[model samples]
Target chain A: MTDSVFLDSIQPLFQDIHAHFTSQPDLNPQAAWDELVQSGFLRLLLPESAEGAGLSVAEALPVLMAAGYWALPLPYVETALLYAALPDALADAIDGNLALAVGTCGPGEPAQPLRLGLHCLDALVTAKDGGITVAPVSGDVEQGWRLQGEVTPLSQVLDIRLLGTAAECLQLAGAMQRVLELTVDYANTRQQFGRPIGKYQALQQQISVMTGHCHSAVMAAQLAAGGMQRSNTGLSLDHHRVAAACGMIKAACQPVVSTAHAVHGAIGVTEEYELHHYTRRLLAGRLAGGSESRWFEQVGQACLDSGASVFDFTLANLS
Target chain B: MIPWPQRQTLPASAEALRSEVRAFLVAHPPAAAADVRARSWMGFDAAFSQALGERGWVGLTLPTQYGGGGGSAFDRYVILEELLAAGAPVSAHWIADRQSAPLLLRFGSDSQRRELLPRICAGELYFCIGMSEPGAGSDLASVSTRAVPNDQGWLLNGSKLWTTNADRCHYMIALARTSGQHGDRQQGLSQLLVDLSLPGITIRPIRDLAGDAHFNEVFFDNVQLPHDALIGAEGDGWQQVTAELAFERSGPERILSAMALLECWCDWLRLCEADTGDQRTLGELVSRLAVLRSLSLSITAQLAQGQSPVIPAALVKDLGTTFEQDIPAMLADQIGRRGGEHGRVELMRTLAYTSIIAPTYSLRGGTREILRGLIARGMGLR
Candidate 1:
């Protein structure tokens, strides 16, 4: 009888993401990606008249959360955000033949050549020089000393990166939740000392700590999402608050991943076990947009730079 | 099973209500200084509470028939969040506005609502929780307080320890043993509205480490009560108390317990020589607070939908208290490493006060150990 319209609406997508986890050796998420795009999952954050879901990031968070929960291997979040940030890339992104990769550049950082759209990626967008530019994925570019792919110059990718970062946080939260659930189930079933290991108070405490980390990660993701919800509010989106939330989520990945594995012990590393499906994604997600430390430092720098009263600044900036 | 938190948004109309709260808080400033702001909700000021009542801010969510504003949860959330952020002394009417009025509206007899709710909404009447006892800590069902049925009313005989504001509150919603003895985890329990002014009831303050007596030992020795004092059906205290915690655990109060200090500490950081490293620490805390507030708001939205979200509520309290407790340590380290001028010294004094009460933040509502267990049970680990 509970009114879960949001979860109820996204249940099919959640099942679709789960259905992608097959007995296949490789996690081929291409099929699921096409299905989601066809279902307009990629347009969730866009405005209503644009054939999008017309929902804010806050409302779209459950979809992102589900993507991670099933360890869906597709870059749906990045694509959706790319479309939201650069509607010009919508056609290519929707085609599924060309995936979008978002790259971030700091002040005065030179344009570096890299493999952004690694798998079936034909287009690359980078934020630099205070402008957003879209470029063709220069053919297999070089790495270090080897010429592997084309090096394309790009600029103004910060907003897209922010979107991608928030997406990563959502996915990471979902994966961590799955890990906690799986580990707890393992503890209940795995026998030790003539009983389920979960019966021990010490282990229970550790699992509890892992649950806390997972919960915090989820909360941080929600915050990041809420910050992005300012899209159509007529109120200028406070990037500082959104960025800090992203930073918190990125930072939380460390503890969440570590505690999850700790609770699982040696079995957590085994390939056959589904735990790594999420842990591996969580780790890669942490590194993709930006590491936790980078974001934390940025948050700190923003606070210091924002003048006078930090309290007033925080109140005004937060969603 | 703990239902997945129903994701909802702050409707545009509700978001518009923030300015009203901001305006109200600005007009009515706190009477205390920075040092006492560290106490957060524990700082009591009946005058301030009554001022809010006059504006119909108190019991903002209760029905208009009971002198309430007949508002949504968001209206109440905005007021409470603003008050909490300012470190306003809300203790005088905190219990009544937060839990008591809601409890009575849900389970209290119709007569009880007509008689006491109006005064409560006016902030003239206050109530305290009577759940914990001398022997029962987190195992609340172990309460030994007994209410024997008599010709006049139930004669209450027992004591409730750690009863917050028992010394000052007008009444207490006590959980007592009605038909079962000790060791009955939750059976045969009942919730009774025992008036503290009645004979056979004693309120003794127990000063904490910070030299404050927010918690006290409430003794009810054969306390006489009228038939109307029983809140709802007898022997349903366990279910009722559990319902009460849904309101208790999830709120801005859980996280705001140490927020005033955090805000003050943020201001204190500016006074320092201001290193990027220290600024980043402030940034870390800010992000944590902002994110936690979002989750808290989500829980509030859940309550508006009439759902019990106990597991998530417990989870929020556990994580919230952890963050609340950590604020002082982080500030103390920063202050210890880089000494500043008067603002830093003031922050230090506030830290001294905040640090002492920090232990109780996680302990008071429900200890971390107990809350974690609840989370574990929600995860099917138990």
Candidate 2:
């Protein structure tokens, strides 16, 4: 049944995943990782030859988005996508969570934060010396690492980075959507001056703007996903996909977070409220795979170099 | 949840049709000057529209029986985006092709469809919407145009304000009060197919701030019409017009109104050695445009599926117009900051014209406030 099920049928499983995480908010990292492993989601992109589902990356996009929506703290994106990127023998050698860490830090600068730093991971994939390297991680061996892995070319690394960025875009989209819903629900129920605040024009206008941001973010993520599906290679990088991912991050990140919190007011920041989980992750997602501005510069510089009109450039690169 | 339809690309067939449109554009490029082309869809040329009709480009989504291409909505989207990007003059058949034919197809009597759809598809007959009036702008239901039933057929005895291209249009799809008094809001409203050449009807053009006379004030003083002029059913105008606005709102025209200006700006940028800041600005606009194009195309996909997604259409119009209006503001700031060194004749002219006309992006179709309110209502916030 898991071999080729439609997304419609898979939705209930996502809802169940959300429910499971919600019910056990304080669960340990090991237990949460175990739940994801039992869910059979990691086999989404594996081929049928390996006794796996053999689904394409396009088909597995919703799963990544659902993981983000639920704020599951495991390295689900890195592990799931790494399955297809790495050879079967190398992939099978890993037993626990696999986290992807980007950037090559110099001597003086502090290392960038690992997105899934708190998770129970078995290896770390890093971009160093213009190539991708994987290092095994053991208990409490967090800070530094010795050379103990094979390296892949920059092009292959870009493929991985693009896929990771697209995943981050979808994640940001899901989180922003949740944040918008939370704000809307809050506005409808929270009363101020004899009526729900949603009844006020000012609040309605602000929330309406927030709705545009959410919708655009979702559209951008879907664009990125479509771009991924259209590319010939498994984890290839396309300019359209990169631009769309950046667009999604730009639209979904700060604009959504600020508006959601502004609408929720003081309660939004408290640990008790559920809004912060999604909002905090939205900010992290914006910075994680690459900030919006970084990708925008690359895309922009290319457009300038092409010497084509914006419409012509966009039609050529994106369409 | 706001149901933004999933992103979709034009099918291979539609992409193939794109080359056809490009060839047509190459053969007959826009004859207007840079400043005039900056008007985009609002730039009217009857000969060009009729030429497109000859190629079956007009009314592409209509049936072949009515002289249309009988193509899918994607076909129309490809044609439209190409036209708007090249700043082609489409105003002559834009209304008739975009919404009028679709509205008539959905709600017109068989005779009405036979008579008007063919001519509209052929680009021989033009239409102007008569929904807005001097007394009614965003509040469309309050329109006071009355078409009283008379012995001949029905007598139209009111006026329409801001009626775009009314002076050139042969017909006006007037939303008049047929069965109820004013202040009844949406009740008893009816749509009538009014011939612009009828006796006692007069059309006078109104010049915009940019000195363009695209809009008109049309008056109907006891003008006679046939009994078959009523579109759809009586007292069903409210629901019918609501459906038509969905077509009017969700389109590439909303986003690409300033595209000509953007092209002009880019051409100038290519000549001069633009810095990283300028490139980044251009890239930001491109990213937004790419996403918006994706969103609009997705909505078009939904349209092809026979769904009238009014709420999503409204949301696109709101966001699209905001993007449209931003081009002029941002580019004008660049001109301002650069001052004398950045002076290029065509670019400056296009920029000035687009800046002058940008305000109407939100004002037309629907106001920003009204669209946001519609979105809020769709979100169940009202």
Residue B378 CA displacement from its true place in model 2, Å? 1.3
Q: Tell me how far the alpha carbon of residue B22 in candidate 1 is from the true structure, in angstroms, after superposition.
A: 4.0
Reference contacts reproduced by model 2: 0.58
How large is the i-RMS for each model, in angstroms? 2.9, 2.7
Pairs with steric clashes in candidate 2: none
Q: lDDT score, residue A196, model 2?
A: 90
Question: What TM-score against the true fold does each predicted structure earn?
Answer: 0.88, 0.93
- What is candidate 1's TM-score against the reference? 0.88
DockQ of each: 0.46, 0.53
Q: Which candidate gets the maximum DockQ versus the true structure?
A: 2
All-Cα superposition RMSD per candidate? 4.1, 3.0
For model 2, the stretches where C-alpha displacement exceeds 4 angstroms are A1-24, A92-118, A138-161, A229-234
Estimate candidate 1's alpha-carbon lDDT, on a 0 to 1 scale.
0.74
lDDT of each: 0.74, 0.77
